[model samples]
Target: MNAPFPIRKECPPGACVCNRQALLSDPQADIRILKLTREEESRLLARLETLSSLADLKKMESRLHEQLGIVLTITPSIHEVRTLRGISIQLQEQPGLCRKTKQAIPAAIRRSLEKSPDIAYAILDAHGLWDGT
Candidate 1:
Protein backbone atom coordinates (compact mmCIF):
# COMPACT_ATOMS: atom_id res chain seq x y z
CA MET A 1 0.00 0.00 0.00
CA ASN A 2 1.26 3.48 -0.84
CA ALA A 3 2.18 5.79 2.02
CA PRO A 4 -0.63 8.25 2.90
CA PHE A 5 -0.15 11.60 1.16
CA PRO A 6 0.27 14.61 3.40
CA ILE A 7 -2.73 16.96 3.58
CA ARG A 8 -2.06 20.59 2.70
CA LYS A 9 -4.11 23.55 3.90
CA GLU A 10 -3.78 26.88 2.09
CA CYS A 11 -5.34 30.27 2.66
CA PRO A 12 -6.61 32.26 -0.33
CA PRO A 13 -4.79 35.35 -1.52
CA GLY A 14 -5.41 38.48 0.63
CA ALA A 15 -6.87 36.27 3.36
CA CYS A 16 -4.99 35.93 6.61
CA VAL A 17 -5.48 35.45 10.35
CA CYS A 18 -7.26 38.82 10.52
CA ASN A 19 -9.44 38.17 7.44
CA ARG A 20 -8.29 41.34 5.69
CA GLN A 21 -9.53 40.43 2.19
CA ALA A 22 -12.46 42.83 2.24
CA LEU A 23 -10.22 45.56 3.58
CA LEU A 24 -7.72 45.12 0.76
CA SER A 25 -10.43 45.88 -1.84
CA ASP A 26 -11.49 49.18 -0.30
CA PRO A 27 -11.86 52.01 -2.83
CA GLN A 28 -10.60 54.59 -0.33
CA ALA A 29 -7.44 52.63 0.37
CA ASP A 30 -5.37 55.70 -0.46
CA ILE A 31 -7.07 57.64 2.31
CA ARG A 32 -4.11 57.05 4.56
CA ILE A 33 -1.91 59.47 2.61
CA LEU A 34 -4.76 61.90 1.99
CA LYS A 35 -5.83 62.21 5.59
CA LEU A 36 -3.15 64.79 6.39
CA THR A 37 -4.92 67.83 5.02
CA ARG A 38 -3.47 71.32 4.74
CA GLU A 39 -5.16 72.45 7.96
CA GLU A 40 -3.87 69.48 9.84
CA GLU A 41 -0.39 70.06 8.45
CA SER A 42 -0.47 73.65 9.60
CA ARG A 43 -1.58 72.62 13.07
CA LEU A 44 1.21 70.10 13.37
CA LEU A 45 3.70 72.70 12.17
CA ALA A 46 2.44 75.11 14.79
CA ARG A 47 2.85 72.52 17.52
CA LEU A 48 6.39 71.82 16.34
CA GLU A 49 7.16 75.52 16.42
CA THR A 50 5.92 75.69 19.97
CA LEU A 51 8.09 72.71 20.88
CA SER A 52 11.15 74.40 19.39
CA SER A 53 10.50 77.53 21.40
CA LEU A 54 10.13 75.47 24.54
CA ALA A 55 13.51 73.86 23.88
CA ASP A 56 15.06 77.29 23.59
CA LEU A 57 13.45 78.36 26.83
CA LYS A 58 14.75 75.27 28.60
CA LYS A 59 18.25 76.01 27.35
CA MET A 60 17.98 79.58 28.60
CA GLU A 61 16.79 78.29 31.95
CA SER A 62 19.79 76.00 32.19
CA ARG A 63 22.15 78.85 31.34
CA LEU A 64 20.59 81.06 34.01
CA HIS A 65 21.08 78.27 36.54
CA GLU A 66 24.77 77.90 35.67
CA GLN A 67 25.68 81.57 35.34
CA LEU A 68 23.43 83.27 37.88
CA GLY A 69 22.82 80.31 40.18
CA ILE A 70 19.11 80.88 39.80
CA VAL A 71 16.98 77.78 39.42
CA LEU A 72 14.06 78.58 37.19
CA THR A 73 10.99 76.66 38.16
CA ILE A 74 8.64 75.62 35.38
CA THR A 75 5.25 77.00 36.25
CA PRO A 76 2.00 76.14 34.46
CA SER A 77 1.72 79.57 32.89
CA ILE A 78 5.31 79.47 31.74
CA HIS A 79 4.88 76.02 30.24
CA GLU A 80 1.77 77.11 28.36
CA VAL A 81 3.34 80.37 27.31
CA ARG A 82 6.46 78.64 26.03
CA THR A 83 4.97 75.58 24.36
CA LEU A 84 1.36 76.61 23.75
CA ARG A 85 0.62 73.23 25.29
CA GLY A 86 0.51 72.13 28.92
CA ILE A 87 3.51 69.85 28.93
CA SER A 88 4.99 69.32 32.38
CA ILE A 89 8.73 69.72 32.82
CA GLN A 90 10.08 67.77 35.76
CA LEU A 91 12.06 70.05 38.08
CA GLN A 92 14.64 69.29 40.79
CA GLU A 93 13.06 71.20 43.69
CA GLN A 94 9.87 69.16 43.53
CA PRO A 95 10.27 66.47 46.21
CA GLY A 96 9.00 62.89 45.96
CA LEU A 97 9.72 63.00 42.20
CA CYS A 98 12.11 60.70 40.41
CA ARG A 99 15.82 61.39 40.75
CA LYS A 100 16.41 61.80 37.03
CA THR A 101 13.45 64.13 36.48
CA LYS A 102 14.82 65.53 33.26
CA GLN A 103 14.38 62.14 31.60
CA ALA A 104 10.61 62.42 32.09
CA ILE A 105 10.50 65.74 30.22
CA PRO A 106 10.76 64.00 26.84
CA ALA A 107 7.84 61.76 27.72
CA ALA A 108 5.76 64.86 28.47
CA ILE A 109 6.72 66.30 25.11
CA ARG A 110 5.83 63.03 23.38
CA ARG A 111 2.46 62.94 25.09
CA SER A 112 1.74 66.49 23.96
CA LEU A 113 2.77 65.66 20.39
CA GLU A 114 0.55 62.61 20.36
CA LYS A 115 -2.36 64.78 21.47
CA SER A 116 -1.94 67.16 18.53
CA PRO A 117 -4.94 67.54 16.26
CA ASP A 118 -2.96 66.32 13.26
CA ILE A 119 -1.86 63.20 15.15
CA ALA A 120 -5.44 62.59 16.20
CA TYR A 121 -6.50 62.81 12.57
CA ALA A 122 -3.81 60.33 11.59
CA ILE A 123 -4.97 57.95 14.29
CA LEU A 124 -8.54 58.21 13.02
CA ASP A 125 -7.36 57.42 9.50
CA ALA A 126 -5.48 54.36 10.77
CA HIS A 127 -8.58 53.12 12.56
CA GLY A 128 -10.61 53.63 9.40
CA LEU A 129 -8.22 51.41 7.46
CA TRP A 130 -9.62 48.36 9.24
CA ASP A 131 -13.18 49.49 8.58
CA GLY A 132 -12.57 49.64 4.80
CA THR A 133 -12.81 53.41 4.62
Candidate 2:
Protein backbone atom coordinates (compact mmCIF):
# COMPACT_ATOMS: atom_id res chain seq x y z
CA MET A 1 0.00 0.00 0.00
CA ASN A 2 1.17 3.50 -0.73
CA ALA A 3 2.16 5.69 2.21
CA PRO A 4 -0.69 7.96 3.21
CA PHE A 5 1.73 10.80 3.91
CA PRO A 6 5.30 11.44 2.94
CA ILE A 7 7.87 10.18 5.41
CA ARG A 8 10.53 12.73 6.22
CA LYS A 9 14.18 11.76 6.11
CA GLU A 10 14.66 13.43 9.47
CA CYS A 11 12.71 10.70 11.14
CA PRO A 12 14.86 7.85 12.42
CA PRO A 13 14.83 4.51 10.68
CA GLY A 14 11.94 2.20 11.55
CA ALA A 15 10.09 5.11 13.11
CA CYS A 16 6.55 4.48 11.96
CA VAL A 17 5.07 7.06 14.27
CA CYS A 18 1.92 7.50 12.24
CA ASN A 19 0.03 4.80 10.43
CA ARG A 20 -0.61 6.98 7.45
CA GLN A 21 -0.77 3.97 5.17
CA ALA A 22 -3.54 2.55 7.29
CA LEU A 23 -5.42 5.79 7.12
CA LEU A 24 -5.27 5.72 3.35
CA SER A 25 -5.75 2.01 3.00
CA ASP A 26 -8.84 2.14 5.18
CA PRO A 27 -11.07 5.02 4.33
CA GLN A 28 -12.77 4.83 7.71
CA ALA A 29 -9.54 5.65 9.52
CA ASP A 30 -8.94 9.27 10.34
CA ILE A 31 -5.37 9.70 11.57
CA ARG A 32 -2.64 12.20 10.78
CA ILE A 33 0.90 12.09 12.12
CA LEU A 34 3.86 14.43 12.57
CA LYS A 35 7.24 13.54 14.09
CA LEU A 36 9.43 16.23 15.66
CA THR A 37 13.06 15.80 16.58
CA ARG A 38 14.29 16.61 20.08
CA GLU A 39 15.98 19.76 18.88
CA GLU A 40 12.83 20.85 17.13
CA GLU A 41 10.87 20.22 20.30
CA SER A 42 13.38 22.19 22.40
CA ARG A 43 13.43 25.11 19.99
CA LEU A 44 9.65 25.18 19.86
CA LEU A 45 9.43 25.12 23.66
CA ALA A 46 12.03 27.85 24.09
CA ARG A 47 10.34 30.06 21.52
CA LEU A 48 7.03 29.49 23.23
CA GLU A 49 8.48 30.58 26.57
CA THR A 50 9.53 33.93 25.16
CA LEU A 51 6.01 34.88 24.18
CA SER A 52 4.34 37.26 26.65
CA SER A 53 0.69 36.59 25.96
CA LEU A 54 -1.77 34.23 24.31
CA ALA A 55 -2.18 36.76 21.54
CA ASP A 56 1.47 36.38 20.69
CA LEU A 57 1.11 32.62 20.64
CA LYS A 58 -1.88 32.92 18.36
CA LYS A 59 0.04 35.23 16.10
CA MET A 60 2.90 32.80 15.91
CA GLU A 61 0.51 29.99 15.11
CA SER A 62 -1.00 32.06 12.37
CA ARG A 63 2.43 32.81 10.98
CA LEU A 64 3.33 29.14 11.00
CA HIS A 65 0.25 28.33 9.00
CA GLU A 66 0.77 31.17 6.60
CA GLN A 67 4.50 30.66 6.01
CA LEU A 68 5.00 26.95 6.54
CA GLY A 69 1.58 25.60 5.59
CA ILE A 70 1.50 23.71 8.86
CA VAL A 71 -1.39 24.09 11.28
CA LEU A 72 -0.71 23.76 15.01
CA THR A 73 -2.71 24.35 18.14
CA ILE A 74 -0.93 25.67 21.21
CA THR A 75 -2.44 24.93 24.60
CA PRO A 76 -1.57 27.54 27.19
CA SER A 77 -2.44 27.74 30.85
CA ILE A 78 -5.17 30.20 31.75
CA HIS A 79 -4.09 30.70 35.37
CA GLU A 80 -0.69 32.23 34.71
CA VAL A 81 0.04 34.85 32.12
CA ARG A 82 3.66 33.80 31.64
CA THR A 83 4.02 30.12 30.90
CA LEU A 84 7.59 29.02 30.51
CA ARG A 85 7.00 25.30 30.82
CA GLY A 86 4.33 22.65 30.61
CA ILE A 87 3.11 23.47 27.15
CA SER A 88 1.43 21.09 24.70
CA ILE A 89 1.30 21.46 20.95
CA GLN A 90 -1.09 19.68 18.69
CA LEU A 91 0.33 19.51 15.17
CA GLN A 92 -2.40 19.04 12.60
CA GLU A 93 -1.71 16.95 9.51
CA GLN A 94 -3.85 15.29 6.91
CA PRO A 95 -3.52 12.25 4.70
CA GLY A 96 -2.37 12.73 1.10
CA LEU A 97 -0.71 16.01 2.08
CA CYS A 98 1.91 17.36 -0.27
CA ARG A 99 5.54 16.57 0.43
CA LYS A 100 6.75 20.16 0.11
CA THR A 101 4.35 21.33 2.78
CA LYS A 102 5.35 18.50 5.10
CA GLN A 103 9.02 19.36 4.75
CA ALA A 104 8.56 23.08 5.35
CA ILE A 105 7.67 22.85 9.05
CA PRO A 106 11.20 22.47 10.45
CA ALA A 107 12.82 24.94 8.12
CA ALA A 108 10.18 27.53 8.84
CA ILE A 109 10.52 27.06 12.59
CA ARG A 110 14.29 27.35 12.35
CA ARG A 111 14.04 30.53 10.34
CA SER A 112 11.59 31.94 12.87
CA LEU A 113 13.91 31.18 15.79
CA GLU A 114 17.02 32.47 14.02
CA LYS A 115 15.42 35.92 14.02
CA SER A 116 15.64 35.94 17.80
CA PRO A 117 18.88 37.50 18.99
CA ASP A 118 18.90 35.44 22.16
CA ILE A 119 18.37 32.13 20.39
CA ALA A 120 21.70 31.91 18.64
CA TYR A 121 22.08 28.16 18.84
CA ALA A 122 19.79 25.90 16.85
CA ILE A 123 20.61 22.30 16.07
CA LEU A 124 18.63 19.67 14.23
CA ASP A 125 17.78 16.82 16.55
CA ALA A 126 19.05 13.46 15.25
CA HIS A 127 17.40 11.20 17.79
CA GLY A 128 13.86 12.51 17.86
CA LEU A 129 10.94 10.10 18.03
CA TRP A 130 7.18 10.52 17.76
CA ASP A 131 4.91 8.25 19.71
CA GLY A 132 1.74 7.82 17.72
CA THR A 133 -1.53 8.34 19.53
Candidate 3:
Protein backbone atom coordinates (compact mmCIF):
# COMPACT_ATOMS: atom_id res chain seq x y z
CA MET A 1 0.00 0.00 0.00
CA ASN A 2 1.10 3.49 -0.70
CA ALA A 3 1.93 5.70 2.23
CA PRO A 4 -0.39 8.64 2.78
CA PHE A 5 2.62 10.90 2.92
CA PRO A 6 5.34 11.24 0.31
CA ILE A 7 7.97 8.52 0.48
CA ARG A 8 11.25 10.00 1.61
CA LYS A 9 14.04 8.90 3.87
CA GLU A 10 13.47 10.26 7.39
CA CYS A 11 16.92 9.40 8.76
CA PRO A 12 20.23 11.20 8.37
CA PRO A 13 23.34 10.04 6.50
CA GLY A 14 26.32 7.95 7.81
CA ALA A 15 24.38 6.74 10.85
CA CYS A 16 21.14 5.62 9.28
CA VAL A 17 18.56 4.09 11.57
CA CYS A 18 15.84 3.81 8.93
CA ASN A 19 17.29 0.84 7.05
CA ARG A 20 18.95 3.20 4.65
CA GLN A 21 20.71 0.55 2.62
CA ALA A 22 17.65 -1.58 2.01
CA LEU A 23 15.42 1.42 1.44
CA LEU A 24 17.93 2.92 -0.93
CA SER A 25 18.03 -0.31 -2.91
CA ASP A 26 14.25 -0.45 -3.12
CA PRO A 27 12.20 2.22 -1.41
CA GLN A 28 8.86 0.70 -2.24
CA ALA A 29 9.59 -2.75 -0.89
CA ASP A 30 8.82 -2.84 2.81
CA ILE A 31 6.53 -5.71 3.55
CA ARG A 32 7.32 -7.33 6.87
CA ILE A 33 5.35 -9.73 9.00
CA LEU A 34 5.56 -8.55 12.58
CA LYS A 35 5.32 -11.43 14.97
CA LEU A 36 3.97 -10.76 18.43
CA THR A 37 4.37 -13.11 21.37
CA ARG A 38 1.32 -14.87 22.73
CA GLU A 39 1.47 -12.76 25.86
CA GLU A 40 1.53 -9.67 23.75
CA GLU A 41 -1.37 -10.89 21.67
CA SER A 42 -3.39 -11.48 24.81
CA ARG A 43 -2.56 -8.05 26.14
CA LEU A 44 -3.41 -6.41 22.83
CA LEU A 45 -6.74 -8.18 22.66
CA ALA A 46 -7.46 -7.23 26.24
CA ARG A 47 -6.79 -3.59 25.52
CA LEU A 48 -8.83 -3.67 22.30
CA GLU A 49 -11.73 -4.98 24.31
CA THR A 50 -11.83 -1.74 26.25
CA LEU A 51 -12.55 0.40 23.23
CA SER A 52 -16.14 1.58 22.84
CA SER A 53 -15.90 3.65 19.68
CA LEU A 54 -13.91 4.27 16.51
CA ALA A 55 -12.88 7.71 17.76
CA ASP A 56 -10.92 6.18 20.58
CA LEU A 57 -9.01 3.94 18.18
CA LYS A 58 -8.18 6.98 16.07
CA LYS A 59 -6.73 8.55 19.17
CA MET A 60 -4.49 5.54 19.61
CA GLU A 61 -3.20 5.93 16.05
CA SER A 62 -2.37 9.54 16.70
CA ARG A 63 -0.63 8.63 19.91
CA LEU A 64 1.59 6.13 18.08
CA HIS A 65 2.68 8.71 15.55
CA GLU A 66 3.26 11.37 18.16
CA GLN A 67 5.26 9.18 20.52
CA LEU A 68 6.95 6.64 18.27
CA GLY A 69 7.04 8.10 14.76
CA ILE A 70 5.12 5.02 13.66
CA VAL A 71 2.26 5.44 11.26
CA LEU A 72 -0.37 2.74 11.60
CA THR A 73 -3.59 2.65 9.67
CA ILE A 74 -6.39 0.36 10.75
CA THR A 75 -8.22 -1.07 7.77
CA PRO A 76 -11.94 -1.66 7.72
CA SER A 77 -11.60 -5.43 7.50
CA ILE A 78 -9.95 -8.37 9.21
CA HIS A 79 -8.38 -11.57 7.91
CA GLU A 80 -7.95 -14.98 9.45
CA VAL A 81 -4.56 -16.38 10.33
CA ARG A 82 -4.89 -19.77 8.66
CA THR A 83 -2.12 -21.34 10.67
CA LEU A 84 -2.99 -20.03 14.13
CA ARG A 85 -6.77 -19.65 13.81
CA GLY A 86 -6.19 -16.15 15.06
CA ILE A 87 -7.43 -13.02 13.30
CA SER A 88 -5.13 -10.66 11.46
CA ILE A 89 -5.62 -6.93 11.27
CA GLN A 90 -3.95 -4.50 8.94
CA LEU A 91 -1.36 -2.02 10.15
CA GLN A 92 0.51 0.04 7.59
CA GLU A 93 3.93 1.37 8.39
CA GLN A 94 5.07 4.27 6.28
CA PRO A 95 8.54 4.52 4.80
CA GLY A 96 11.41 6.46 6.40
CA LEU A 97 10.65 5.32 9.94
CA CYS A 98 13.69 4.20 11.92
CA ARG A 99 14.26 0.42 12.19
CA LYS A 100 14.38 0.72 15.97
CA THR A 101 11.15 2.66 16.03
CA LYS A 102 9.60 0.19 13.61
CA GLN A 103 10.55 -2.74 15.82
CA ALA A 104 9.06 -0.99 18.84
CA ILE A 105 5.81 -0.19 17.04
CA PRO A 106 4.01 -3.29 18.29
CA ALA A 107 4.83 -2.56 21.92
CA ALA A 108 3.91 1.03 21.31
CA ILE A 109 0.62 -0.14 19.77
CA ARG A 110 -0.15 -2.15 22.90
CA ARG A 111 0.50 0.92 24.99
CA SER A 112 -1.76 2.98 22.75
CA LEU A 113 -4.46 0.35 22.97
CA GLU A 114 -4.26 0.57 26.74
CA LYS A 115 -5.22 4.23 26.52
CA SER A 116 -7.88 3.68 23.84
CA PRO A 117 -10.73 1.82 25.47
CA ASP A 118 -13.17 4.16 23.80
CA ILE A 119 -13.05 3.28 20.10
CA ALA A 120 -14.13 0.75 17.45
CA TYR A 121 -16.18 -1.84 19.27
CA ALA A 122 -18.25 -2.59 16.18
CA ILE A 123 -15.12 -3.25 14.19
CA LEU A 124 -13.54 -5.68 16.61
CA ASP A 125 -16.89 -7.12 17.55
CA ALA A 126 -17.41 -8.24 13.98
CA HIS A 127 -15.30 -11.28 14.83
CA GLY A 128 -16.60 -11.43 18.39
CA LEU A 129 -13.16 -10.54 19.66
CA TRP A 130 -14.54 -7.51 21.47
CA ASP A 131 -17.55 -9.20 23.04
CA GLY A 132 -17.60 -8.42 26.74
CA THR A 133 -18.61 -11.96 27.61
Candidate 4:
Protein backbone atom coordinates (compact mmCIF):
# COMPACT_ATOMS: atom_id res chain seq x y z
CA MET A 1 0.00 0.00 0.00
CA ASN A 2 1.27 3.44 -0.93
CA ALA A 3 0.67 6.24 1.59
CA PRO A 4 -0.50 9.57 0.24
CA PHE A 5 1.63 12.65 0.94
CA PRO A 6 0.23 15.42 3.12
CA ILE A 7 -1.77 18.01 1.26
CA ARG A 8 -0.60 21.62 1.42
CA LYS A 9 -3.11 24.44 1.32
CA GLU A 10 -2.36 28.05 0.75
CA CYS A 11 -4.80 30.70 1.83
CA PRO A 12 -5.24 33.96 0.00
CA PRO A 13 -4.97 37.23 1.89
CA GLY A 14 -8.69 37.85 1.68
CA ALA A 15 -9.45 34.36 2.96
CA CYS A 16 -6.77 34.26 5.62
CA VAL A 17 -8.04 34.19 9.21
CA CYS A 18 -5.13 36.27 10.52
CA ASN A 19 -5.98 39.75 11.77
CA ARG A 20 -5.39 41.53 8.50
CA GLN A 21 -7.20 44.67 9.56
CA ALA A 22 -4.78 45.13 12.44
CA LEU A 23 -1.86 44.77 10.10
CA LEU A 24 -3.43 47.13 7.60
CA SER A 25 -4.24 49.63 10.34
CA ASP A 26 -0.63 49.96 11.39
CA PRO A 27 0.43 53.52 10.39
CA GLN A 28 4.07 52.56 9.95
CA ALA A 29 3.47 49.44 7.87
CA ASP A 30 2.68 51.19 4.58
CA ILE A 31 4.95 54.18 4.28
CA ARG A 32 4.81 56.02 0.97
CA ILE A 33 6.91 58.74 -0.65
CA LEU A 34 5.36 61.86 -2.14
CA LYS A 35 6.89 63.56 -5.15
CA LEU A 36 5.96 67.08 -6.17
CA THR A 37 6.64 68.78 -9.46
CA ARG A 38 8.18 72.22 -9.79
CA GLU A 39 4.82 73.88 -10.35
CA GLU A 40 3.21 72.06 -7.46
CA GLU A 41 6.11 72.90 -5.17
CA SER A 42 5.85 76.53 -6.11
CA ARG A 43 2.12 76.52 -5.47
CA LEU A 44 2.70 74.97 -2.06
CA LEU A 45 5.36 77.54 -1.18
CA ALA A 46 3.02 80.31 -2.21
CA ARG A 47 0.34 78.90 0.04
CA LEU A 48 2.82 78.63 2.89
CA GLU A 49 3.86 82.20 2.39
CA THR A 50 0.29 83.28 3.06
CA LEU A 51 -0.52 80.90 5.87
CA SER A 52 -1.52 83.15 8.75
CA SER A 53 -3.64 81.04 11.09
CA LEU A 54 -5.11 77.63 11.82
CA ALA A 55 -8.18 78.61 9.80
CA ASP A 56 -5.98 79.14 6.78
CA LEU A 57 -4.38 75.80 7.39
CA LYS A 58 -7.80 74.18 7.41
CA LYS A 59 -8.57 75.73 4.04
CA MET A 60 -5.22 74.56 2.73
CA GLU A 61 -5.89 71.07 4.02
CA SER A 62 -9.24 71.10 2.24
CA ARG A 63 -7.64 72.33 -0.95
CA LEU A 64 -4.95 69.67 -0.74
CA HIS A 65 -7.58 67.02 -0.20
CA GLU A 66 -9.55 68.19 -3.20
CA GLN A 67 -6.57 68.66 -5.49
CA LEU A 68 -4.15 65.99 -4.27
CA GLY A 69 -6.42 63.65 -2.30
CA ILE A 70 -4.11 63.82 0.69
CA VAL A 71 -5.17 64.01 4.34
CA LEU A 72 -3.07 66.24 6.55
CA THR A 73 -3.22 67.27 10.19
CA ILE A 74 -1.04 70.21 11.13
CA THR A 75 -0.59 71.22 14.75
CA PRO A 76 1.62 73.48 16.82
CA SER A 77 3.92 71.83 19.32
CA ILE A 78 6.13 73.09 22.16
CA HIS A 79 8.75 70.44 22.19
CA GLU A 80 12.20 71.32 23.47
CA VAL A 81 13.93 69.74 20.50
CA ARG A 82 14.93 72.26 17.85
CA THR A 83 13.50 70.14 15.10
CA LEU A 84 10.10 70.05 16.82
CA ARG A 85 10.28 73.51 18.29
CA GLY A 86 7.82 75.00 15.84
CA ILE A 87 5.10 72.75 14.46
CA SER A 88 4.38 69.23 13.27
CA ILE A 89 2.45 67.79 10.39
CA GLN A 90 0.97 64.32 10.26
CA LEU A 91 -0.47 62.47 7.31
CA GLN A 92 -3.65 60.72 8.29
CA GLU A 93 -4.27 57.20 7.07
CA GLN A 94 -6.64 56.83 4.15
CA PRO A 95 -7.14 54.50 1.24
CA GLY A 96 -5.11 55.37 -1.87
CA LEU A 97 -3.04 57.87 0.08
CA CYS A 98 0.76 57.66 -0.13
CA ARG A 99 3.21 60.15 1.36
CA LYS A 100 6.99 60.43 1.63
CA THR A 101 6.82 61.34 5.28
CA LYS A 102 4.39 60.90 8.15
CA GLN A 103 4.67 64.42 9.56
CA ALA A 104 3.90 68.02 8.43
CA ILE A 105 4.33 71.63 9.55
CA PRO A 106 1.51 73.81 10.83
CA ALA A 107 0.55 77.35 9.83
CA ALA A 108 1.99 78.88 12.97
CA ILE A 109 5.40 77.54 12.13
CA ARG A 110 5.16 79.11 8.70
CA ARG A 111 4.15 82.44 10.25
CA SER A 112 7.04 82.27 12.69
CA LEU A 113 9.47 81.43 9.93
CA GLU A 114 8.29 84.40 7.83
CA LYS A 115 11.26 86.44 9.01
CA SER A 116 13.73 83.63 8.34
CA PRO A 117 13.70 82.82 4.65
CA ASP A 118 16.89 80.80 5.00
CA ILE A 119 15.31 78.41 7.47
CA ALA A 120 12.10 78.22 5.43
CA TYR A 121 14.09 77.65 2.27
CA ALA A 122 16.02 74.86 3.89
CA ILE A 123 12.78 73.18 4.90
CA LEU A 124 10.90 74.01 1.72
CA ASP A 125 12.17 71.13 -0.34
CA ALA A 126 9.84 68.76 1.48
CA HIS A 127 7.16 69.12 4.11
CA GLY A 128 8.64 66.11 5.90
CA LEU A 129 11.78 68.09 6.66
CA TRP A 130 9.83 69.81 9.42
CA ASP A 131 9.81 66.55 11.35
CA GLY A 132 13.47 66.13 12.22
CA THR A 133 15.56 67.78 9.55
The top-ranked prediction according to TM-score is: 4
For residue 72, model 2's alpha carbon misses the true position, in angstroms, by 1.9
Could you tally the backbone clashes for each prediction? 0, 0, 7, 5
Against the unseen true structure, what C-alpha lDDT does each candidate score?
0.37, 0.44, 0.47, 0.46
What is the full ranking by TM-score, best candidate first?
Answer: 4, 2, 3, 1
Clashing pairs in 1: none
Cα error, residue 88 of model 4, in Å, equals 1.8
Top model number, lDDT: 3
Order candidates by lDDT, high to low. 3, 4, 2, 1
lDDT score, candidate 1: 0.37
Q: Which tens-of-lDDT digit does each residue in 1-133 have in candidate 3?
A: 3444334434456554445456446745542222223344355445645554566666766764564344675533456422221323344545445454444544444444445532333445555664588
lDDT of 1 by residue, 1-133 (tens): 1113321122345442322233234553322222223454345335433443444445645753563233445433322233424433444442111222234343444454455545333333343423653
lDDT of 2: 0.44
Writing each residue's lDDT as its tens digit, candidate 2 over 1-133 gives 3434543233343543444454556855432333333455456556655654445656777865664345775343334323223223456766533344344543444344445422222111111112242
Off by over 4 Å in 1: 1-52, 77-133
Tens-place lDDT digits, model 4, residues 1-133: 1113321122355543433344345665422212233345455756665665545556777876775456776544444324434545666664323222222234434554555545444443334445665
**Pairs of colliding residues, candidate 2:** none
Off by over 4 Å in 4: 1-36, 76-86, 92-133
lDDT of 4 at 18: 30
Predicted candidate 1: what Cα RMSD to the true structure? 23.5
